[model samples]
Target chain A: MVKAVINGIPIEVEEGVTILDAARKAQINIPTLCKHPDLTSSASCGICVVKLKKNNRMFRACCTPIEEGMEIITHDPEIIEIRRTVVELILSNHPNDCLKCGRNNNCELQKLVADFGIREEHFDKFVRDIPKDSSTGTIVLEASKCIKCGRCVDVCQNMQDVWALSFLERGIHTRISPAGDIKLADSPCVRCGQCSEHCPTGAIFEFDETSKVWEGLMDPEKYCVVQIAPAVRVSIGESFGFQPGVNLTKKTYALLRRLGFKAVFDTSFGADVTIMEEASEFVERFVHKKGTLPLITTCCPAWVDFMEKFHPDMIDHFSSCKSPHEIMGVLSKTYFAREKKIDPEKVFMVSIMPCTAKKYEITRTDEMFASGYQDIDVVLTTRELARMVKQAGLDFAQLPEEEPDHVLGDYTGGGVIFGATGGVMEAALRTAYYLVTEKQFPKVEFENVRGLKGVKETSIKIDDTKVNIAIAHGLSNVEYVLNKIREAKKNNQPMPYHFIEVMACPGGCVGGGGQPYGVTDAIRTLRSKGLYAHDDAMKLRCSHDNPFVQKLYNEFLGKPLGKRSHELLHTDYKARPVYRK
Target chain B: METSVVPDIANVVEKWKDKKGNLIMILHEIQNQYGYVPREISFQLSKLLDVPLARIYEVLTFYNYFKLKPPGKYTVSVCMGTACYLKGAPELLEELHHILGIKEGETTKDGMFQLEIVRCLGCCGLAPVVKIGNKIYGGLKRSDIVNLLSQYSKEGAPVAQPV
Candidate 1:
């Protein structure tokens, strides 16, 4: 432990702890722009500069490690003035269009500017006239608004391993763009939006489609129905005054109803259906030897895009099931509409997702049109849904709790846990074990496959056979698991694992790109805990235990992987060109 | 798409394959060989070198040395340094553009002349200098641009004199 004096207060901290963290432990907040908890400190932004007590040499608090018997002054009149000047210099190059910006009040730069009370610009204004890149159709990149913090670059290249966004040029001429000045849609972006999530300013953000959703809702000829994803219920409340991870599923349903949706469904129900097909497919492959071993989950669209672009050879190993929301979209227009005596054409299905890639996933393949029309007409991020709630003048916090329509709204504990990193694997194991052994395990929680670990590996015994499993969340962590599998295949060794689950974003959908902003490890844990808590409180804890799911299989689809189920729920994957000519 | 260029680019990439931070050096070689880094070459390099196309372009566009388009046979560069700027270099550039019918960084449609602006040529003593090929024309006026450009024109292929 190293003893440090911060702001005249002495404290003890671990050796190698940054002064910023040590000061944070002492309850002092050092302002930072480029330092995100999920990324290593580049110290590109000098906003977190602090003074050493003896010689008073300036040091960046983020990158500097605490030493024994070091006295540091984090804040003073001179430091505040210097910090304010730094912000002013940044603002000089930044556009004064915050009100028109997508992040608006939610932007971290805007918050810091407000906190520092920067009312007047002291530096000469010289904003770059760079045009916006909206070609991706998932996230927009406004180069002129970029502060050159390098957070997005770190997230895209180092964290997500997408390598889409790169810093072009040096000095003031530097700007973020695809590696070769090509359009982002033409680059190997994969539309993950992790860059946008890590961005501090309005430089990168989700492509706004809320107005289109509003138009669909206002159309009299259209019966607009909506479904909320599992992760969304736990994280959406962050936009409001509610604490992070507070379950807002009931309130969300009520708000969607008040937002003029004809019906509100839960994606957890779709997740339940996904497990039904996925677990049966796993059993058919593992027990019956019908297909390849180590069936990978395809619920996260960003992961699917990554797989198609980078690992097309693994297509045979992917489960042929549509994502939870896509399943909900098809069922909303087909099963729910036919049962309710409504026209599927007029049924506009909108999915409120915790992902930006979900916007891209709606029309990815022909299976999305299984209901004879575009199953999901509009996809809104959790941020977009929050904006709609605010626009509708509904007090989300005080909205009376309400239930979704009975048919597609019912879900199980296994379905609700599909939002976290190891969720899909855990949920699939619960039902896969049951299908394999014809017996229910008393302990349902797979503790080994939980938490925000980059890569999690475990083995579960189903009757007599040991089922080895590996779960990787962040895209960067996926390469290790994939290389191991490749090594095993090269030597013709026994399969490294029987099942693998991957989510593109860190901590799965709980830390998804399009969720409410300001996500960190603490927030991811809290949001995941909220999902597990909801699962624990549920009566039915398995997908097969959900009575409505069983009814859907019995009445409409004959079996889990029957002809009708395959037509309505399954999809195929193909290798895609990384760059479009 | 061009199969002939693949082996050449692969050889260039092979030279820098073992080195760290070799993207800029590789791009410099590609630009030197082709006079500009073509999009197709960049795409091929991305595949051969196992680097993202975006990262390659990031390096290509960063330094002003790399160009994405071909240059003209006889390049005309007008110094726009501070000394030249005060001595009507901007007017000289405008007059040259009018005569050549090509903007800065662009080649003529017939592929004879290209116009460009340079920060400095270290010739402040000869303010407002214009260089075409190997010859330097210093202390040029706005009117001198047309005659200087016409000398290189196909119709008049007269032997030009350095000012």
Candidate 2:
């Protein structure tokens, strides 16, 4: 440990700790850019400069380490001017289009300017050119609007463990660019929306597919059938100014009805079906290790794509079960069409989701078209639905709560949990436990597995055979745990997990990239609370209790992982190329 | 271990090559497999594929995702994801930059600490996160990044560049 004085207050910090960290330990706030606690520091912003005791030199606190007897002055007037000057220089090249930008009020640069009371600007704005990059389906980058804070660049390159953005050029010419200066659409961006999700300004914005959905709605000939995912009901309330955990499921259903959708359905019902197929597969794999050892969940398309591209060797580990949205699309077009006595071609199935990856998921060639067309037609984000509600001039909060149409809307708690990080694992467990033990599983909560946190791993013994379950939310966490498993192999140890669930976004669907932006852990917890609250309110908490799935097994699919199940619900994967970097 | 197609580069390598400027995704896949995405395959992707070499090179250089050079045996990518940043990525990133001087996308000359910055990596619970290759060192502090890098010293931690 090194003893250091930060901001004139003497504090003890561990050896090798940076001055910024030391300041943090001493409760001294140091503003910074190109530096994040979650990412490796670059110290490029020079915003965190502080005066060192002996040398009297102001150095970036992020890169400087604490010496045993070093003195640091964090907020000295000279230090303040240095920061203010840096801020001014950044603003000089940055676009001042805050009012119309998406992140206007929430922008970091705006907040910093106000925080520092920096009003004077002298540099010419025409020196640097900023353009909007909209190649990616879900996000746009307005380079001019960026303060070069590198928050977006940091998130894309470091946080997600998917490097899709970087700083191009040097000094004043430095700017963020996607690969090869290509539009985002051409890159392997995955449309996770993390960059926009973290952008301090309107630089990164979500691509609104609302107008297209609205166009289709105005076209009366189109029988638009909307399927709301489990996470949407909880998150949609936020757009309407409701509390985070509030249940707007009924209100959402009613709003969709007023908006002119022909039928309102629950993705939970599809999740129920997914659980049926997944649990049965789990039992077969666990008992026999016959198929993919350590079966990985396929519910998150982002994880599936990642594995396909990078970890194809682990492909067999994933259950071939399609996610609830795709399953619902197929069933709605097929079973629902037959039930309604309508041609499947006439019905358009759309998914209301908390995910941006679903956009790419639907584009996959394997996504079915039971009606002999694309199984799902268009996907709207939770935010997009809220926008459409606003555009329709409807007050979502005032709308009376109502239930979804019968058959497809009815579901269980097991299905609702699919929106959470470990929800899929927990859902699969509810049924897998029963099938594996040949008796009712003791614990229903699976309390060990449920949380809005990142990576969670646990093992349970079923009939004396221990089954390990690992759950990871978001890409970086997933990458870590997966590597741990690989390290175990290198160490000559057997694999640790038997089943793994990976959600591309944080907190699973509740913190989806396409959900409301500005959601923190506190907000994610509120939504997660809504998930469990909704679960507890339900009569059937387990997937096996889903009568529809039972009926499907009794009628369409003979059994789980059966010949029909393989043909309808199962799919394969492909390996992808790594980036040269 | 035999590097069969660099870890994760599967059949879809060809498809990624087909899409112009898809080098970003291709680089991600390659990085996933080999711990560090190599330029050899990236060059191959450009020559045999529709994407122009200049475009591919520019893409590799532009995006933090596409590394134009070989990666060290271990790559430490810190997630400055929004959640992590709100928590503490800025602090973590600072120490890493200082410890390894090549900036966000550059690798150490010794090929030890190939520091990269990735976007959102999903673990808000474990904010201030750093993934050295596939191993995630979560709830990170400045010391943690240094310690993790030091562990690779036998393999090699980057020696600081002389002023």
Query: What C-alpha lDDT values do all the predictions have?
Result: 0.90, 0.76
Candidate 2's C-alpha runs over 4 A off are A1-87, A111-121, A126-131, A183-186, A452-454, A479-494, A555-558, A579-581, B1-163
Give the number of the best model, judged by lDDT.
1
Q: What is the Cα-based TM-score of model 2?
A: 0.70
- Worst lDDT run of 10 residues, candidate 2 chain A, spans A363-372
lDDT for residue A367 in candidate 1, whole number 0-100: 89
- lDDT at A329 for candidate 2? 86
Q: Write the per-residue lDDT of candidate 1 for residues B1-163, one digit (tens) a residue.
A: 3434543877888899989988888888888898988888888877888887777777787788898777888889999999999999999988877877778988989888878899899889998999987688899999887777777885545477786
**lDDT per residue, candidate 2, A315-404, as tens digits?**
777788888999888878777887787787778788998877788777675545534678888888887787788778997777888888
- Residues A2-101 of candidate 1 have per-residue lDDT tens digits of 9989989999999899999999889999999989998899998799999998998999999999999899999999999889988888998899799899
